[model samples]
Target: MKVLEKQARTVDEAVQLALEELGVSRDEVEVEVIDEGNKGILSFLSKPTKVKVTVKPKPEEVAVGFLNGLLHFIDKNAKVKCLPEDEILKLEIESEDAGILIGKRGSTLDALQYLTSLVVNKNCEEFVRIVLDAENYREKREDTLEHLALKIADKVKETKKSIMLEPMYPNERRIIHTTLQKDRKIVTKSVGKEPYRRVIISLK
Candidate 1:
């Protein structure tokens, strides 16, 4: 669970403002109005009340939770110890046989990661992005993706021809789009169908 705090002149305003900033709705948050500004008499000016708001993490957990669960299962089923680390609700699991959780092509691992993040973020009233990783796989993949984005951007610039990149997951595609979007001489666009879709980088 995450705790997000904010202040506003009124309870409604505090909630509304927090909701906007947190990307959450009224139902997602439990609000506490800590203070109302002071109102002074005659010679003094009235000050708007200050409010303190704390937002708690939602109950919903994501796919990563399932991976963590699976890790537990493996530990119990195979007698391997699964250690868990919760960094601000971002769960990282370390086990003796972490490879089993990773699975082939990291598919099982990805599924678990995806679910855990989904559940945690959905239930989290605050904008807490839950990241679950086992054996540093996600970190390595992220590094690779970052390098690939840079490589592709360089290629697009060198060739001076619109380059079509391999289809990628939404996150990967986002990385590509973000990496090249700032280039003054080029523009990026996503084309093709889902699963087989790809991004196009063209000279603008």
Candidate 2:
């Protein structure tokens, strides 16, 4: 949300000035006429109109602002780019210090994503899914997970023994489960609780 107060000769003029300053259309903002100018005698004695203009809440903008501040706070000269669509907002972090933001196995990235999602959804009428990624980290990690699933499936079949993978986040487990679902000869199941949940691959 962004707000500006402007004083002009009329309410409409004040609103127009505010809109121009905010860089948004009239319909995109909520305007409140604080004081309608009074032409006491002639235009020389008139009082100026005052109004407050607020840009409606926009989730993508809020997310970008929050992420940029957070990045700067962490002493990183990163850039935030937004790709917005219906029900989803994707933010990409570009910087030379990508490794720090990504953290081990993308834990830092995931944490930042969670915090950003919370900020974006605050006071919003609808929930929007947020995805934060650095250097296409999510896609690269997904590819790696898919490959791991296939390799482990092959190993399980070759050794004729069930294999339990290290605990993985829910989405990671989902990738493993979905990738192996087509293999009728191989079965995948997730066991244990979240943050410690492990995926099991064995003979069906």
Candidate 3:
């Protein structure tokens, strides 16, 4: 965030000047009226109005900064590319050693994304959702999940018995549920508590 103090004939004027210097609109800044100047004795100006202005951090900027800082600890060459969408901030981490950050089952990537989102929304009026990906892991994982769902559907139909899948993140579970949602012969339900929640596929 960039902060500045400006003095002018009035609070509004001071804030306007600050905004002009900062090259940002009023909505993008937090304005604090430090002093409402007053007219002194004999029609003399006592003190000019003073205001403190600070630019609000945009969600993308915050995400990039936060993820880059974390990436530095893991890999110096790692870089985060932010692609902003209407409702989500998409962060793509590119690194020669991306697999390290992705970790087992993308645990590390998800952890970093969670932290980045927390930091991004800490001051936001409307929460901004973040979609973090590394080496297109999310799409790849979705494809894998879809394939698993199809295979499980076949197994369930052949055995006439339900199969409970391994624990999955909410997103992964969503893939399972959505992948089989349209199938007439298969049904999917989430069971167990979080961090161990599983999808149970059964014959419809």
Question: lDDT (0-100) at residue 44 of candidate 2?
Answer: 86
Candidate 1, poorest ten consecutive residues by summed lDDT: 76-85
Candidate 1, overall lDDT?
Answer: 0.64
Q: What TM-score do all the candidates reach, one by one?
A: 0.53, 0.77, 0.94
Give me the runs in candidate 3 sitting further than 4 Å from their true place: none
Best by TM-score: 3
Per residue, candidate 2 scores C-alpha lDDT tens digits across 116-200 of 9999998677788999999999999999999999999999999999999998988889999999999989999989987899999
Model 3 Cα lDDT, one tens digit per residue, 76-146: 99988989888888999999988999999999989998898889989999989999999999999999999
Question: Regarding lDDT, does 1 or 2 come out ahead?
Answer: 2
What lDDT, from 0 to 1, does candidate 3 have?
0.92
Write candidate 1's Cα lDDT for 23-101 as tens digits.
Answer: 8777766776566655568426765544544455433344344554665656643222233345445556666776777
- Clash counts for the predictions, in order: 19, 0, 0
